[model samples]
Target: MSDRAPQPVERQLPTEEARDLLALVRELAQREIAPTAAGEEDAGHFPREVFALLSRSGLLGLVYDEEYGGGDQPYEVYLQVLEELASARLTVGLGVSVHTLACHALAAFGTKEQRAEYLPAMLGGGLLGAYCLSEPSSGSDAASLRTRAVRDGDDWVITGTKAWITHGGIADFYTVLARTGGEGARGITAFLVPGDAPGLSAAAPEHKMGMKGSPTAQVHFDGVRVPDTRRLGEEGQGFAVALSALDSGRLGIAACATGVAQAALDEALSYTAGRQQFGRPIADFQGLRFMIADMATQIEAGRALYLAAARLRDAGKPFSKEAAMAKLFCTDSAMRVTTDAVQLLGGYGYTADFPVERFMREAKVLQIVEGTNQIQRMVVARHLAGPESR
Candidate 1:
């Protein structure tokens, strides 16, 4: 063997291969997701069929391990696919992302036995997972969650409620964080509680301003039983696992934000190019042209930030701060971009006739979920100021 280090294959894909995948994803989004998205939102219907289609296409496991029947693709590629999906239907895109977050604990920290027992159904399209982190009393201050998991011989008896659980009523499983130690962050631990466990129930779906098709509810766990084997990692590891999952999950939200922005820009561009005003195309006006330019520029910047953060994570680098930054920046940018996109559409944008208003509604949740933008700021500040700063 030569003394020199072996050459590493390029992590980045060839341009042609990337383009082909993008084209395929875009086609799927347009052909499958776009057609029913408006009606689904209007009727408050979940597009269960769209998720089945995605599962059939292997998009659900895009960033998972190949051994588990995942696509084993890079996060960079996966995020781009998410962008396309959200551009068509944000509800589906976000639901997919949330499902992945709920599944993250088993994938990252599960024992080999646990992995073998659970990974297949989760990786396959047969099961969907929901992350349970937030509570009615504990939104940003997750460490103070009041949910309790008491050891009861071979099984743990969990009692308390998990609020704002995405897919709470519909998911096959829930990854719950509850107190197992004393109080505060150190006291928390994670458990893989099946959705059908006895004493587990979900409240009626929340009526939200946007992403109406996606369900959100409070999950009550009254003496829900989980085997000791279902405990994820060691006791008191819940906080770490939740934070780790959030770092990755934030990137997913950022990607969704980028997609929302891109969709708005594409719509604005198409409408302005042909929809005439002053007896000519309004796109020709310098003011309107400048607005479009700003939209495109901001979208590109946000995309770059999130992609860079994803790359860091895939490479096993410390990515928490970067992920928070990307999440905060991209979601904020999305709120601005989608609002501007509606403005570009003039009266039509404000009405249900165009998709811009819908996009705006969908964009708002991205900032609030995963971790609120305020929480994201706190996370970033902690990283910058060190442990001593108040």
Candidate 2:
């Protein structure tokens, strides 16, 4: 197989600048990312230096205000860039999305002082970040998180554990959500915790099904003292901050899912067109051809779903329902498409010699991350039928 999969689907972009930006991202993905993805993934090595290069290229800060070193791009353009990166390597694409989610709370709700102090460095300083919202006991119901943050003289002493943290051990900083008042979501608060805080540590990285190149771990905060000034938004408002981040983050996952699906479809087509069966290319077989057609259709539908949601966000309107729908449909489509790709390649797709197995593994997490497909359905249903009756 070639170093790269097929080129991306043609995108409808609004500006000359947005089109140019996509070109740049695709070029970088093909050259700097796709070539090394398989080997690095097998080694389970996080490519920190690639992130540095992305920072230098100003790719890391897309969709944020430019005043603090962000790219000032709209979500529509930014998400397409993510799709391209993910097609090359999901570890990079999803990593950038999580980092952006980590930045959302501070950028949206931080005091002017906090933005001036942190945004520039966080956005472009080559510093990676992790979001800490899930805990060992809390998964679907994040409002039930048990981590506690108690007030000190002028500081807050945090104590608890966060689970499934992306970039956990290697992050430069963490955006942590912990209980600060009475029980429940409203009592929680968001804090910007430095990775080197004296009591902060991470458990050994989880051995995962895929995206081994990206680290996931349980991060422990034991009396990690953070000044009140580092708190994001108001006290009792951290859950709100987290929900906001997840709404946007769900869209990011949708785009990444579409990318993975697209890559799988591309590989399957390439393989079938070359492999011969009964003295003819397997592409001539109606069964395989139908499967390829279905995969391509789903990928296109998934891409359109995400881009529509992204445009809603760019227009400054409500997009939560669309985001959830995108996340659900796209991730489900990715699972189906990747599984089919593996089937098309027969035994080779199941082996490490091909990347489809890895793609299938990575696709599983998109269904689970940000929110499960079940949670996505809940979110979308709430929009249509109103909140569940107590």
Candidate 3:
């Protein structure tokens, strides 16, 4: 493990303000996040206070409209911030991404009244949020979700289970998708459900291979009722809203994967340079040097791929294909790079004494989360060859 702090990544920012924002993010990650990461993750402790601090610092909502208390930065800037945070702690970085996804439905599709009433607090007023889409039976096929919302008078009563929800038990609010009519994607509708809404409850958190500090649990809505006023977008438009949010959310995952891979690479470089082998530094060897070169190239390529996707999004161009590609390539690269980092460290990398082992475990989940690499390939293929026929 590297005792020294990892060097800051050289980012290409469009504005001085973005550069300042990145510097602040790096400082905060070093001072507040990195030091306690291993211990907290070992203890399975979620750092709620860290999120509150992020809210206070206006780091929670960088890409939304300033009118809603967001920083009004471009997506490119926001992703770089995510990368910095994830390098320090995956829980915090991925938590911010999920919160941003949770905010997307209402922020992008809600009426002005809804945004004015809810967006401010959700964005930067210290509230945490979760996006509820995948159910026990609906992972990749989110449109097949069975959580039903029945309308009675002016209110809708929700009933069903949402699985694999980050911030599931602890979120201040949840942006949920539920079945309102018929079946399939067209039947789904979006709702802003309070975390404390009646009959809403969360099961015990899932025991996971990694990211134990970040809660992932099953959230149940049993006759949880909210008024029609809480509905986001028109009925039957929820699937589109969810898909739109995911295009951006996948980019968030890509940035985090890059961050993790970079962290692993830094550790490998530090260890190889210091650990003596046959009376000389192991880094002096050709085989190890080639491995390090490959890792660095992968990290740089992943960063560039994600940033390219983000720029397209900021320009209001169609970017779903690129987002999928970035997510696919970056996460796959992270898995490979982290594994090599472990191999480079030899026996030491397999132990909890060093961070590389943990980084390897964390990298595994990135390949599976948001959308799996297989799913990402499907998404990219859809753009090229059209959707699969039933």
Q: Residue by residue across 1-390, what tens digits does model 2's lDDT show? A: 334447558999999999999999999999999999999999999999999999888988898889999999999999999999999999999999999999999999999999999999889999999999999999999999999999999999999999999999999999999999998888999999998999999999999989999999999998999999999999999999999999999999999999899899989888888888899989899999999999999999998999999999999999999999999999999999999999999999999998899999999999999999999999999999999999
The alpha-carbon deviation from the true structure for residue 255 of candidate 1, after best TM-score superposition, in angstroms, is 0.2
Q: lDDT for every model?
A: 0.87, 0.94, 0.95
Query: Which candidate comes out best when scored by TM-score?
Result: 3
Cα deviation in Å at residue 14, candidate 3?
Answer: 0.6
Candidate 1 residue-wise lDDT at 242: 95
- Angstrom error of the Cα, residue 262, model 2: value is 0.8
- lDDT tens digits, residues 35-92, model 3? 9999999999999999999999999989889999999999999999999999999999
State residue 262's C-alpha deviation in candidate 3, in Å: 0.7
Q: Which segments of candidate 2 are over 4 A away from where they belong? A: 1-5
Best by lDDT: 3
Give the per-residue Cα lDDT of candidate 1 at 350: 98
Listed in order, each prediction's TM-score against the native is 0.94, 0.98, 0.99
